[model samples]
Structure formats: C-alpha cells, structure tokens
Target: MEQSSKKSALSEKDGVNQPQSLSNSSVEVIKQMRRKQPSAQELIDGILAKDKVALSRAITLVESTNPEHLEKANTIIQACLPHANKSIRIGITGVPGVGKSTFIEAFGKHITSLGRKVAVLAVDPSSTISHGSILGDKTRMEELVKDENAFIRPSASGETLGGVARKTRETIILCEACGFDTIIIETVGVGQSETAVHSMVDFFLLLKISGAGDELQGIKRGIMEMADAIVINKADGDNIAKAKLAKTEFNRALHLFPAKQSGWIPTAATCSSYTKEGIDTVWKTISDYFELVKTNHYFEEKRQNQNQFWMMETINEQLKSNFYNHPEIIKLLEENKKAVQNDEISPFAAAINLLGKYFKS
Candidate 1:
C-alpha cells in the first residue's frame, strides 16, 4: 500500500510538469502564427487601423527581395495610395556626431506633444562586408520610443547610396497611409545622402553644430544650398555663444545665394536638445515654410515633380536589374571581363559585345 501511494505521488508530479510543457508549446504556437506571413488585405487593414505590428510587417514586406513578398508589397502600397500624400514629409540630414539622434528625440517629442502622429524613418549605415544595418537609432531615441504618438523605425539593411535606403520613398508612402500627420526621414548624414533626401521631402533641414572651423568640417557646399532651414543644435552652456555666432554666419551665407523658387528665404536657428531650449523656434520655422510654399502653389508642384522623378528612377533601376540578371548576360560578362583584363579585348569592345549578347538573349 505504501509503494502504491508513492507511485501515485510521482504520477501527480509528472502531471504537474506536463502542464508547463503544454504552456510552452502553446506560447510557441502563438509566436508561429504571428510570424506567419499576413495577407495583403490583412496588412492594409491593420495599417489603416494604426496597428504597429501590421505596419512593421508591411514595411518588411516592401523591403523584401523575395518575389512573392514583392508582389504583395506592391498590392498593399497600391491599396494605401489614396490614403497617402496627406502628411508633411520632412528630411533631416547632418554629418555624423553632430547629435542628429539627440536633436531628433527632442524635436519628435515636441511634435508629438502637439497631438500629431510622428513617424521617424531613420537610415543607418550598413556593413559593407555583412550587408547588415547597425540599427542604433532605436536605442538612441529612447524618449520618442516611449511616446504613444511616435513611431521610430531603424534603417533597413540593403543597397544604399548617399546614406538613403533604396526603398525609402515607398516606405514614406506607407507611413503617410498609417495616418501619421508628420513624417521625418533621417538620412545617413553623409553629404551625398542629402541630395536623395531633398528630392523627397517638403522641407529639407540641415542640422549643424557650432565651432566646426572654416570649411564647416567637410560639409559639401551643394548641401548647404539645398537646405530650407539650417538648425544649430546643442546650444546650451559654453556652446551657446558659438552657436549664436554660427547662426549669424549661416544667415549671412544664405543671403549670398540666389532666391529660392518658393520665394522663401532659408532661415537659421539655434537649439539645445538637452534642455529643450529653442526647440519651438525650429518648429515655427518649418510651419512658416509650409504656409509660404502652400500659398504660392509650390508645394503641389514640387510633389508632382517628385512623383515623376521616382517613376523614371524606377524604370532605370528595373532596366539595370533586367540586364544584369539575365542568364546569358551573366555568362558573357564573366568571359568579357577576363578578356578585357587580359588585354585580349578593348574595354569598349567588351561592353559592346556584352550588350549584343544581352539583347539577343
């Protein structure tokens, strides 16, 4: 009888462990379901409802290189097109270590406080060897991450130039569709990245710092010309005097440039992100810019041009892909490359030969 009782107790202990195993299995099943690819309608509905999970999935789908995902991503974008173009798109660029992330955190929190939904599409540098992103933006913008009205996405990993991701333009449309009143795209801050950002945004903000010496520490002159507003960040404590001087210098520099097409002068402001000082002045500058451009009809015209530019860019990208991805062209390229390298053929001849093979294939 004692042996039987002991056996029964052991059985009960095993039963208790079974529930724990079952619980883990159930959790995993739920995770698998979430990981399962969602349908186009499901993604679109979730995005329209401002579901963060769905919005993130949709962005991943758009960034995917898989053919099936690409098709679905296109469908989702097409469905959301009508709901887009309602938000103001702003592009922020600056050299690295200029406190871009800190300034954005302060600025984003301020924007969200005004009851506006803000989305930050921050682009981070990718490793050339691994082809992966550093993904440090999310960690940097702690305050904005906690804000209910703000959404911050780290840079996607893939081919990029001038620090702007290839699919950023499409991502902007998705953000706008998600009912975000303000969309901010933060570029990788390299000089070339500014041009790409400028083409997509209503307002291009060039973030600068004080005491950077005469050449502005390698910032391209062309980038300065593209700015709609120049903001000097980190203007607290000992930096305040230098910031004011920098602001004055920038204001004088703007006067030397020809007037903008919108007939609005690019303005300069100084701000301290840590203390939240002068943040409002930056917002006011952006607001005043929108009013001026809208009044003169430049806003609509610029968007129209941007659309046309993207259309051509898409075509160019597709043509290049088609040619390079062709099987015969791939084989011919290898042969022609070796021939040119060995002095067996001229570079031009090799290129023409490859083109002929590509067209025939």
Candidate 2:
C-alpha cells in the first residue's frame, strides 16, 4: 500500500511536469516563428512613441517602389492622415552657384532655433547622359542637417522633369504627417519648368546671386512670375551693392506680374548666406506672407487644392507606369520604333497608334 501511494505521487508529479514542459516548448516555438507584420495603427503608434528609427524606416518605405512594402506604406500613410496638415511647406529654388544650400542651412538653423522641427528635401535631377545624379546640395547643408530638430532627405529625380523626383510630393505628405511642422523642398535649380514645386508648396522662395545678369537673362518669365518671394543671395561685402541692385530690379519686375493664387504680392530682398545676415528678414517676409494669406482665409483653401492636385498626380503616375509595363504595349512600342526608323510611319502617327492600341479595350 505504501508502494502504491508512492507511485500515485510520482504520477501526479509527472502530470504537472508534462504541462510545464509543453508550455515552455510552446513559448520557444512562438519565439522562433517570424513575428506577424505590424498593422498601420501599430506603425503609427510606433512613430508616436517617439521612435526615431521607426519614423526613418517608415519614410523609407513610403519612398520605396518595392511591391511588398507598397501596401504597408499606403496603410501607414492613411493612419498618419489625421495627424498631418500641421506644417508649413516651403519651396526653395535657385540657379547653380546661387548659395542655395548655404542659405537653406542658415534658414533651417533659424527656424529650428525657435523649437520647431524642419525637414529639408534636396531634389537632385537625374543626368540623362549618365543616368546618375550629383547630389552635392546636402553636403553643403552641414550645420542644419546636424541639428537634432532637422531631417534631410536627398532624392534622385531619376527621369522625372521639373527638377524634382516624382515621389517628392508623396514624400512631402509623409513628412508633414510625421509632425515636422516645417517642410522645405529644395529643387535642382532648373531655370524654368519648376512651377510644379510652386503648386505643391505654400511659399515659393527664389534665390538669386548678386551678379547673375547673364544667368538670369536665360530664365523664363513663367518661373519669375510664379515666385511669392525672391531672395537675392550673396549680398555681402563687395557684392552688397550688386545684391541691392538685383533686389530693386526684381521688385520692379515683380510688380509687372500678376498676383499669385494666394493673392499675395511677391517681395524681393537681399541676403548674405555666408554671414547669416538678412536671414531673419527673409523669415520675417515669409511670416508676413503667411499672416496675410491666413487672414484672407486663403491658406486652408490653398492647401486643400494642393492635396487634390497631388492625388490626381499620383493616380496619373500609377496609370502611366501600368500602361508602360503592359506586355502588349511594350511590344507595340518596340514595333513602332522600328517603323519610325524605317520611315514606314510618321512619328506622330506611330505615337497615336501606340496610344490607341494600349487604351483600346
């Protein structure tokens, strides 16, 4: 009877030990298994949790064309929608050697000093001949980029026109969603065809050098007329007089142009990026412009329109990509190119035929 009682006790111990072993094994299995992908809410929570690393990764996903990440990116963007629209979007552009980067660093430093966050995006146009971009602008923005409150992203324009990457507009949305509060987009100083940036940004700032007479001569009227504010850079020491003269000329030139969509008049001022002088004046003008537009109730309306514009642009980009990727369309384009080379069809006719064939159901 004692032996039977001892056996019963052993059985009871085994029963409890078996369950404990299984429980430990189950946990080990769970730990070895791949973690389930995070939901959009989870992603946003991670971002709001002040996870800078997560924010950086999320922005990368949004900028990516990876098929696997696109859905996740879209979801994250949706979650971030409500928390967005709290930032000021500024577009800065100038010809080469106009101290664009210097001014930006100075300007960015000034903004962040007020305890606001600034995100600067450099748009480097892709070189047609080499299929590469010389992304040197960010290197010049050393001081601002080092600031804890500043984030800098340099994007390759790739075959996109307008001196900006096609994804730049989308990137702006993501940045604003991240609580940046101030977003600055710097475009490759393409003399003209940069109005695309103007449409997307609240303030369009044009930077000019003091002695760019020949360079400015080549600039088209449309870009000049599109500017909300013109900044004559390099206004230090010997060039101060020339900078002052350029400012006067620009001010006079601006008067001849019509008002912007915001109905705000563009102002021209001189500044020395090297010395950081006149930087405050530039910011003050921007502040004044914001006050004027906000008071007129044009600020909100302008932002709404910009959002709609970007939506249409995004759709068009997707459709274009799809149309080009279709197998039959690709073959048709190749055949059309051969026909054009053989003089069997006119260039215009081939284009029409290819487009019609692709679109025909």
Candidate 3:
C-alpha cells in the first residue's frame, strides 16, 4: 500500500525524481537549437529555402563587428547575391507627424494581399545613439508583424552612419534571398538619413500631412526633388478637401524642380491609413514608374551605377575604419586634433600629416 501510494501521488518523491513529461529527444532538440549558431552554408541553404530564422541569423552576422565573422558574412552574401536584385527596393521618408508607421502597416498589408512577400526595414534615430532600437512603430505594427508574409527590422546599430547603411544594404540581399518581393525602407527621421536611404532604393516616396496652412512649410526642396511620389496622408472625413489642395500644391512644386534623369515625372497623391483609401493608387503609381524605367532601360543602369557607387563607399568606409583603428594613428590623431584645436597647427596640415603617417605605417 505504501509503495502504491508513493507511486500514484504526484509528489517530489516520485514525480520530481522521475518526470515522465521530460522527453530526452525534446531536451536534446532544445539544447541543439540553443547551442549552435548555424554556419554560412547552412544559413545560405536556409535562406534559399525561405526560412525567416536563417534570414534573420544571416542579417545578424552581417551586422556583427566581430572580425572573425567577416569572412563567413561575406560567404553568405556572395551566395545570396544571385538571388538578390529580384525585388523592388522602395524608400519612404517623412517628418515625424506624417504617420509613417500607420501608412507603412496599411501599405504592407495591401502588398501582402496581392500575394507578395514584403520586408520593412526602418532607419530609426534611436538605433544610432543606443545599440537597441526604440522605434514605437514596431509596436504599432502589430497586424503587419503578425502577418506571415511580412518581416520588419529596425536599423542595425553601427560605429558609423555609413556602417549602418552598409548593414541595411546587405540585409536587403538576405531578404531577397528569403523570397521577399517588396522591400520598403522607412527613414524615421529627417536630414541626411533620407539621402542615405535614397541611394539604396529604386523608388523614393515622400509622405506628408495636409492642412499645414502653408501647404509646404518645413518641407525641404532637396527632398521634394528626390521624391518619385509625394503622398498626402490623413485624407479622410473633413480633411479630404485639404488633402486634395495640398496634393495640388505638391504637384506644382514638383514641376518647379528639374526633370528627373530617368525621364519619369514625379506625381502627387493622397491616402488615409485609417480608411486605407488611395493605397492602391499609390502602388499603381509605383508600378507605373517601374514599367517606365524598365522599358527605357534606366532601371538596370541605375542599379548598376548604384552598385559601383556603394563599392567605392565601402572602400572609403574600410579605409577610414582601418586608419582610425590603427594603434599608432589613434595616438597621433588625438595629438593632432588637440594641436589643431589649440591653433598650433592648421586643420588641413594636421589632416595631411595624419594621412602621410597612416600610409607610411
């Protein structure tokens, strides 16, 4: 009786000592998942097989600064390269109040509705100062985040802005290899970030709000010039008339800018993320632009030119990183910087001196 009671009772004496629920194979699988970082070939095969886990790991490798992972990262990228350039890279930028998050979520859902895989990459400001992202948009993107057809990632933190951009560009390749057809890059802040994103994307969309009174106050001329389409958001209910007026103003302003080299004219439109109105029209505009560029052969040419430009940019980034990280140059840089600050040496002369020493070393 005592033995039967001990055996049947769910207590530490029996249950804890010999838990039937803890399967050995399950434990081993969990341990395996935790223990191994997948190799480059494994990552490549997984990405090609459309595994998001593999794609995410490959991106982490690309973002890693550990010198040891560089070759492995390069291997993954080279393997993924042929599978890239098949997706359309779109960059969306706007000022803080423009509702970029809501717009993107709605836009992404629409794209996924068409049976296309979408990846949204954000260039958030906080990632620069803090290694971790502080994008409120991520939480706001609940629906899109839950969608299996969509993947969203914030900017990877880096020692320099160029490094951040480079990591993102590399991430694009991985996403493409993973079978994402539409890549949307969101610039979370204004300024040079827009320019950096513009270089990497095929379509540059500028989102704005209506009823600002001035219709164009606080908007940068350079941003307007770069815009392939200027979309006025919040165009619903009582704001509809205001949005239409703002759209007309933007159209007039776009006309003032010189013709784009692609020979594609910029367009102005309006959309409401709340109602999801005009979203299809915006996508149609993008499709029309792609058709035009592709038919004129400018699409491939632009991508080729961008590839060359980023190649040089990569070289510059590497050279600068190597020069500053060099032990001898690091010591001299501080001395030279202080000397220039104290007026003991000209800034240009100090720069030349550093370069001369760098090349000699």
RMSD, every candidate, angstroms: 4.8, 12.3, 5.5
Candidate 3 local Cα displacement, residue 218, angstroms: 6.0
lDDT of 3 by residue, 1-361 (tens): 3555445455455244656878999999999988987889999999999998888888888878788787899999999999999999999988787899899999999999999999998766645445665656669899999999999887643444532345888999999989999999987655667777888899999998887654757245877888899899999999999999898888887878889999999989999999999999999999999999999999999999989988998899899889989999999989999999999999999999999998998
- Model 1 Cα lDDT, one tens digit per residue, 244-313: 9888888888888878998889988899999999999999999999999999999999999999999998
Better of 2 and 3 by TM-score: 3
Judge candidate 2 against the unseen true structure and give its global Cα lDDT, from 0 to 1.
0.81
Rank list by TM-score: 1, 3, 2
- Per-model TM-score on C-alpha atoms: 0.91, 0.84, 0.87
The TM-score that candidate 2 achieves is 0.84
lDDT (Cα, 0-100) at 177 in candidate 3: 88
By summed lDDT, the worst window of 10 consecutive residues in model 1 runs over 12-21
Q: Pick the candidate with the highest lDDT.
A: 1
lDDT of each: 0.88, 0.81, 0.86
**Backbone collisions counted per model:** 1, 0, 0
Report the Cα lDDT for residue 278, model 1.
94
lDDT winner between candidates 1 and 2: 1
Over 212-251, each residue of candidate 2 has an lDDT whose tens digit, in order, gives: 5733562448778778888888899898998888888788
Q: Which stretches of candidate 1 lie over 4 Å from their true place?
A: 1-23, 214-220
